[model samples]
Target: MDMWLHTANGQVNLRVSRQLYTVQSEYQTIEIFESPEYGRLLVLDGDVIFSRSDEFIYNEMVVHVPMAVHPHVKKVLIIGGGDGGVARELTAYADIEEIHIVEPDQVFVEACKTYFPETAQSFDDPRVQLIHRDGLRYLRGRQGEYDLIISDSTDPFGHTAGLFTKEFYGSCYRALREDGILVYQHGSPFFDEDETAFRSMHRKVYHSFPISRVYQAHIPTCPSGYWMFGFASKQYHPVTDCNPQRWQARNIKTWYYTTNLHRGAFMLPKYVEDLLKEAEAK
Candidate 1:
């Protein structure tokens, strides 16, 4: 069967060349497929996690948006993203001291190391500590432990259903040091099925954080062409407190995320803004 993602109206399918790896991981079905359009694709529980070609767009925005605004980020906690692509982007900054990636399925992580070695190679870095455990559990008892936290998790269902609740975002808030930021892709605003859940998810995150904002990116492999990321912080305002010049000075090379685009990312469309307003009101 050709790899496909279901949309609100219909579905999108990619031309798959062959299967690279397929396994039944403890937590989910792990599969890697070679596609003519997107190159190597990672699928967990039949969901498109990331594709090599467009991963830079997703990884860069989710990492650098907070990295640019928050002046100094020394340690980071990444929930999911066992593929190591997320950590790979963070390692570009010399100031990042510790990068922790927690994945529930050890088998999926191993598959990334073998098939996506270039991205997964971040695990070999001295700074990254790959934790084989549930991220929600990992965040428990972690108070003021990290400068930043990135939830690179899959959509809320099956294996990750627990992550979308109010308690989990509160856990994320407590896990971060003062001035820390949390960024995670919250799904698309365009899809009919996702719009309600996205608003609710935004509401839950807003409840946990004093400053909660949503941003957009075009991720082709995702369920919809449009995707949103939540930017929640304890102190820093993603736009007002943002220090773009200081971040630009670091000269971290990136494909999609730039210091200039950081502000624009937070500039939501009118419809999206209305949704956020409605979410906040409810």
Candidate 2:
């Protein structure tokens, strides 16, 4: 018999085989399951955060796009990326000297370290610093410090909803250096509810940063399989400042992100374009 796990809204049922590990942390429920289709699966609060088979797509896009655009990114900060996938990608680059992660849940980190060793290996890097604290509060005093800040957080709900607020974005803006960039998971723009949140987030981030834009990535396991990421910068535009030659010189080979795709991701669909316009109107 096959096991099934329903994702957000319980609208889709993902097939599973054996339960590997389960933990009820103070923050949320974390589960690891072996799925024949997706390989190792990581679940938090009943939401499928990532499946090993396709995680490269989401993780690579989220990390590489902004990094490729920024000429020199040395200091990086990640908020709420408990799975360590984001940190794993950042550490792969030798140019990044320090990586500070502010994740509130230690249980989630241990769960990832135990079950998803490949992704969790990020913790082994000497450059990575994992801090157990709320990401919002962690950024309170750090101003003009990080060259890049990536919020690889959960969807906006429960305790994470604050991450989407104008106040949190303001903090992120202040935490970044003058030429630094901010990248984060901006939910999906395909559904009504998700699009509403996306538009609101874009509006709030726009107010905080001088330049901001939304980009797309395809994640088969996420809601609707079409995900969005936000790029906000004080000095660089995602496409204009992106140096394909410079990134290629680093010899970083990625599964989903390419310099060509980085240029193309910012091309929004009609509906998404209209949504941004509508948000601006309000």
Candidate 3:
């Protein structure tokens, strides 16, 4: 059977070679299957969160770019990354003291443990504490505790809608230390509807944080092949403040992210620059 996912231009059809598992969690439906091209595909609430083939592209960029900027990331908070990919990346560092993943759906986490063990094994790390609570509510009153906060939620829709709002970002901003960094998926800029939301979300974050930057990664399974992520900080600037030498000393090996590419990711296309410029102008 062919599984279809909506994209900016049209729809991407993944040729499903085998159906592995389907489970309904408290919040959403989780599906695991194999696609001839994508290998294992994780579908949540009718969207492809990631496919084994290209997950590294998304996970590496989201985790390493920020980690490279903040030299001493002792503690990190990942919101809605129940798939465990983000935590898996953070666990690579020996200096990182704590990694907290706040995911509301227990069943989804369990399913991931069984199917995507590559990422799920990260939950077993002693430094990582998986909290079975809503990410937004969990951040409340935890002022200035974490050095990095990763909003790894799904798209800006359904239960994930709150993750992109001003109130949610305010909670994240307050929860981070003065030098903390905030990074999250900032949808595609190719389509009309998604573009509007992307601009609005960046503006909402810009209102709260001083240094707001956007970066891009191309994941074929995502709505638009061109996907962007937000990187905001209270003190550190992503480019000028990036500590490539210090980060390299840690010896955290990654397949996709590099200090050279880290600088290039922020060098947006003129069209993308125009998009963020429009957001800032409004």
**What's the TM-score of each model vs. the native?**
0.95, 0.97, 0.96
Displacement of the residue 244 alpha carbon in candidate 1, Å: 1.4
lDDT of 2: 0.89
Candidate of highest TM-score: 2
lDDT against the true structure, per candidate, is 0.87, 0.89, 0.88
Can you write out model 3's per-residue Cα lDDT over 1-282, one digit (the tens) per residue?
A: 565444333545567777799988779888887988889999887677899999999999999999888878999999988889999998898889999999999999999999999989899899999999988889888899999999999877788788888999999999999899999999888877677888899889988899999998889888767889999999999999988898888888788888999999999988889889989987
Cα displacement (angstroms), candidate 1, residue 21, comes to 1.4
After superposing candidate 1 on the true structure, give the runs of residues whose Cα lies further than 4 Å from its correct spot: 1-10
Question: In model 2, where is the ten-residue run with the lowest total lDDT?
Answer: 5-14
Instruction: Look at candidate 1 and tell me the lDDT of residue 211.
Output: 95
TM-score of model 1 (CA atoms) = 0.95
lDDT by residue for model 1 (1-282), tens: 674444234545677878888999779988888988899988777777788899889989888889888888999999998899999999999988999999888888888889998789898889999888988888888899999999998888888887888889999999999888999878888866678998999999988899999988888987767789999999998889888789889999987887667878888889899999999998
Cα deviation of 266, candidate 2, in Å: 1.0
Worst ten-residue run, lDDT, model 3?
A: 3-12
Candidate 1 residue pairs that clash? none
Candidate 2, clashing residue pairs? none
